[model samples]
Target chain A: MSFKVRQEIATCGGKLLKLSHFSELIGLSMDVNVYLPKQYYSKDYEKVIPTVYYLSGLTCSPDNASEKAFWQFQADKYGFGMVFPDTSPRGDSVPDDPEKSWDFGIAASFYVNATKKPYDKHYMMYDYIHKELPVLLDEHFSESSTKKLDFLDNVGITGHSMGGYGALTGFLKNYDANRYKSCSAFAPIVNPSSVPWGQKAFKGYLSDDENDWDKYDPCKLIKRITNTRNDMILIHQGTKDPFLKDNLKTDLLTEASKNTSWEGKIDIRYADGYDHSYFFVSTFVPDHARFHAKNLGLI
Target chain B: MSFKVRQEIATCGGKLLKLSHFSELIGLSMDVNVYLPKQYYSKDYEKVIPTVYYLSGLTCSPDNASEKAFWQFQADKYGFGMVFPDTSPRGDSVPDDPEKSWDFGIAASFYVNATKKPYDKHYMMYDYIHKELPVLLDEHFSESSTKKLDFLDNVGITGHSMGGYGALTGFLKNYDANRYKSCSAFAPIVNPSSVPWGQKAFKGYLSDDENDWDKYDPCKLIKRITNTRNDMILIHQGTKDPFLKDNLKTDLLTEASKNTSWEGKIDIRYADGYDHSYFFVSTFVPDHARFHAKNLGLI
Candidate 1:
């Protein structure tokens, strides 16, 4: 698959390349934004630049976080590249929510591989993000250079809201294989199987079996996975977030980790008076960048 | 002149107060956003907080800069409050562009008092922004407090594109009166009298008298104003900005300053690979904040 450059925007100490490519897995074109840090453009830089993938929340395209999250500055500060993948596949062939709801349709793929009819044809976001996209990026961006940009290894993952759930699930699911070196989130949905937004998405994309939903739920995965290293999952939740009460029950993840290897390793910081908006995400991005940088060995 | 609190959003150790109030000067309700830094909320804060006024470019509301410019973090870092004033008067009664174009009427007031028919009725933005807004904000916000917020004295002014022109004109025209302590611009049209955008706006708002436009034009004002304080106006112009060659001839300001008291005082820093967007503005906000902080005696 070849990546097409849509726009190259200069921001902070680097360039944000808006790219689109045809995905054989999804059978449709997908959009993703990649931010190359200042270090990559430096004359003396020789080391391979690590990447930090940011998954956005509900009803968002790649542009939302790419435009507003203020990640470019942090990426430059930490000398790390950034990858912002789209939430779902979008095209005429892509099946939308029957009811035309925002939380269940085109923008809300939940980062899960679909097993149901219609959706199964194209909604393979889990494979697209976690597997295909990384390999493709590594191949495409490293073609002309002796120094490489690491996309798979020595990479960290972070997200917000639904994408937060995606990051945690992906990180924990592939922990044994050592997939993501670091993981963090801003107001993520920790217990997705128990939340309304996740329940609707799970039912729409996955099979009717409840066991299918449990595999993708972070709360359930944390209970089973044993942390071999002294690894930590950083998370920030706003006390004033409207979804905290109903959907993003962050405490459940901590409670589920009790007596498990992740008991004290889940650092969930409760921010005061913040909400479920980019204002909240951008505020905590610097801290997340530092955490990811340390894990990726950039700091 | 009471302000209605539309929304109070917590952002980066500050609160962005979205307020709407009736403006007697413009004969319409205006929306404005004021950010109170963390210093304002500190129990030990005794010093009166200074403010920096940010004016947005064409086709913008107060929310544009409040949401995208990433200024809240800088305001908190420098311990300064921020004021984002609306560009023009708006209502059903207000006249719009005859061609329904975005550059004229409605959002495009060009920060000038209209002297022509139809627009003259409510398009008195010059008085509304520079004269009335500060007094109204001071009166309303200081009513219940012993410590005052300095909206009038010890304040800085900066803007983007058209608003950049506004900042330069305002700073130079009121230099003798000591209206603003500091001034800066991002990709500003330095010589509006010689530009097409300026010509259209000036013709539509002011009468056929070219002398009326000369008063508001920064190039003309820079030649006449005496910079006795050795004050320097900081400006950042992106080299890749599409409007640089056309509407925004930044070099004209420097040329006009030559042989005058303000020669070499107009510091225009040409940023590489940047454009005319919030991405460009947000990148340079920290620099502007520090500049203003120094001038406002906060540093």
Candidate 2:
């Protein structure tokens, strides 16, 4: 219903803005971590930099990605701004899950367009994150042709696990597919159709028709359509992930890539002994940002 | 009871062991994060590496230091093993403050010898962390050297907030203080006797006598004793931290060091716009590690 600016910390000349906003979208007061690149405070109003939005996985809020992954160093190096959105709504008339855990209720929104009754109103997370949140970020955080980022600079997308799924599907279905110069993910769940989390959330959110699942499946979408701008996708998967066998099917992605073509290429690196955690992401996020920078012509 | 390792990821040719343990010491199981340096797994059994244990402040678990602080990059670089023990015992057995939200009961144990009952039993966290945990870590992990440390080489201590107090007291009282080559912290609670957190935990766990608090207070102890070692203590504090004036009193440390006739030195840096969060620590840990590494003769 109402949004508040909780805290703002100036980091490396730029500002790290922590905002609390009531989302008609996610139906809770969401905390977003927005980074205005050093250029924003450089006094050069004409200089504009590209932007990158990072979505986090289940059971995690905006702070997890902003604080844990150490992404700012890379953002500083690459001269890009980063936006991190909380995973789900909290502290409203929202219903709590009977099982009190990190997953399922508060944090484990699968980033889907919810259709279920109690969840549908507040659970419009997909729209809020992909549509409304970005709009608000662009308006409040973005420079007014005024400085850091140009009025028309395209924004890139990247995430992990559920976020990776959101990054893929949201970018694909959104109007700004061409705006993102490059996309990447770390240990992302590829085919939700075949995973337990996917099965659970999908059954509750989507109609029972399995045919509709492919519309949201990244592996399936990649297979069905050719790229609009790039030839390949950049992905990093851990070989020893606990959820790899059941949830994240990189094999299916490999299989899908074989059939479908993109604009440039797909660079998939399978790191050994990493897991479905922030440690794995922190280890490779610099490289991922570099990957996007290269595609975006920043490097 | 039962000890189960949730995850163990190899890093820098060693392992970042995340295990949940059944504690006879704490009376309940706790999740701990341990880093066994490469020397632990090396073929040369005669080689000994000094370890630097890190303690975190309030609302932090073992994972905070291990995962969020970005210390491993430097730990590997410096060739020193790192061990992070949980701040307090978890689960229902650990009595929480009925009123307070963040500070007193669960996350904020002052790492002193607990004298209060109920809490005194499970809250002997100081000994559990500094003594018993190290022994358990040695038995389970490959780095099974309890008291054995490389005195001739480099050993150091560093922490944040309450953990900073632990590092200061721990290093000062080591059976061999000369073993520690360096000392540092980020926004540490300098004079625990003066702060609310210190007052609460100390009054609860320790006697009301103010002089007794000096044993654990770095600023107090520094004035009363002389350092045999000829190394400098590095401290990094954020200028904008809300708790800077009252909670973290580095000014007392500055005054004490000025008057103390010690051979050791203190170098404190006040970073601008940073807060008392891992975001602040992660931003500066590399420099801290590098400082230790240079002193450790690894750089």
Candidate 3:
């Protein structure tokens, strides 16, 4: 339940704290980064700061978004804090891809609770990220600081690629419970069950039964969930992304919401000439921040 | 004389064109990245876009600042163009550091023309960056597009660490000729002739004559150059930078300016808890951009 501060980095009008903590769910050490906006350090600030959770893509750590996403400036602008969670559980004993490919294993947990052998031991990332991490963060911040930083409620969720799928799935799965107030993604694999990257991860982590895959698929989850609040899910996809045709079928998610309660509520923007990199993600971050800020009532 | 478009990346509200060209000065193929602001692509923008040349530090290609600096947003906000020049001339024919050290050869040219053997053949970065590159860029852009992108007179210069030293040296040395309109630096080595990193670069690139080193040292140049335009050189130094004490002594430049015409004109801001990495550089980019925009009459 205790976190070790690895490094405190001074960024744009904020401090990025890199922390590592032992997770009981996964039984391993996990790394996360938190960016405290300038408002957090100001003596005159009195209001509680809301949070935005950003999950990273394949082969990425918390450091990737912390360094390149350019989110600190926006967090400071909107008076909100940011949380960057690692992509997957990592350790020497953790099971990795037998082929040692980048799209699966150590850095790619697909944000699912594994029921399969070998992966079941430490790859409980879905539970670790959405469930345990938030409670731990709330307890830690409450014990350490006089300022109130919300980690449970008044939170927004967003991610890139695989994490995008995770965010969509999480937001949809917990829609009735009101888990996240806002959700967005950058070049996300919407229908992962159909994509090669998603299929591989699902097969490796979930089970042989195809029905189990629908539990985490954003396309399928959108059909079952009811959007009572008229909430909008913002998404940005690059037209020049190499994985657009093969892995990220952005149109499928929109197609899935054709007649459901989620119809006309998902905003999928196609950006021209942008690639599936931080260059593209950081560019559209300001828009996403504003979207989340509006939904979180920070604007 | 011609540049090859390696990649044109869409970032922020503009495009980053990665270009490679054959330089007559260095006699080697050089790579440079030009970021055209959104104004260039807009129909209403009629004024020539001012340019800001950013020189990267040791062991860095043009890609480092292009990907990490987060300068594109500022460029779009202020309607200014950005130029990122490579640190050194690289090829198999070009000589490298005898010790294979990062601080001496290859990516550490120190932006000085070499007068020594071997290095003298291709290490002509001083002329290449300040003189030849600008003319070539002007000619290239003039032929390629209708949008007037200024790379010559209406320009500012900035860099980090060794390149920070380069920016200062180039601005000060060419002050009389009015080469650059504004100048700023991030954690630059002020007194390069005295510091270990600078000493190594100067020794490897220049001749044995100690007088040759004085020609490029910013501390020495500041004392000799007269500040007539009431112009201020903006500089940001991190207090927690690992190389602050050993390599980057920010006070030396201030001390050198004492009793000289340039006294009280050097704005060296010491940022607390920041390091020598791009994190520190990107954090203060907005301030520097505004400073240059004001100096270049863009504000």
Maximum-lDDT candidate: 3
DockQ for every model comes to 0.72, 0.33, 0.82
lDDT, model 3, position A123: 95
TM-score of 1: 0.98
State every prediction's TM-score relative to the real structure: 0.98, 0.84, 0.98
- Native-referenced Cα lDDT, model 1: 0.92
lDDT ranking, high to low = 3, 1, 2
Candidate 2 structure quality by residue, lDDT tens digits, B1-299: 24477878854346787888877877788877767665566666444566667888898988878877877766766577787777887777677767766877788877786777767777777667656666675565445444333523356678898888778776665524464576778888878888887888788777778877877787777776654456677888988888998888877788777756542377889998888877788788888888877776666
Tens-digit per-residue lDDT, B144-212, candidate 3: 899999999899999999899999999999997889999999999999989899888888888878889
Using TM-score, rank the candidates from best to worst. Answer: 1, 3, 2
Could you give the DockQ of candidate 3?
Answer: 0.82
The Cα RMSD in angstroms, rounded to one decimal, for candidate 1 relative to the true structure is 1.2
What is the total number of backbone clashes in candidate 3?
0
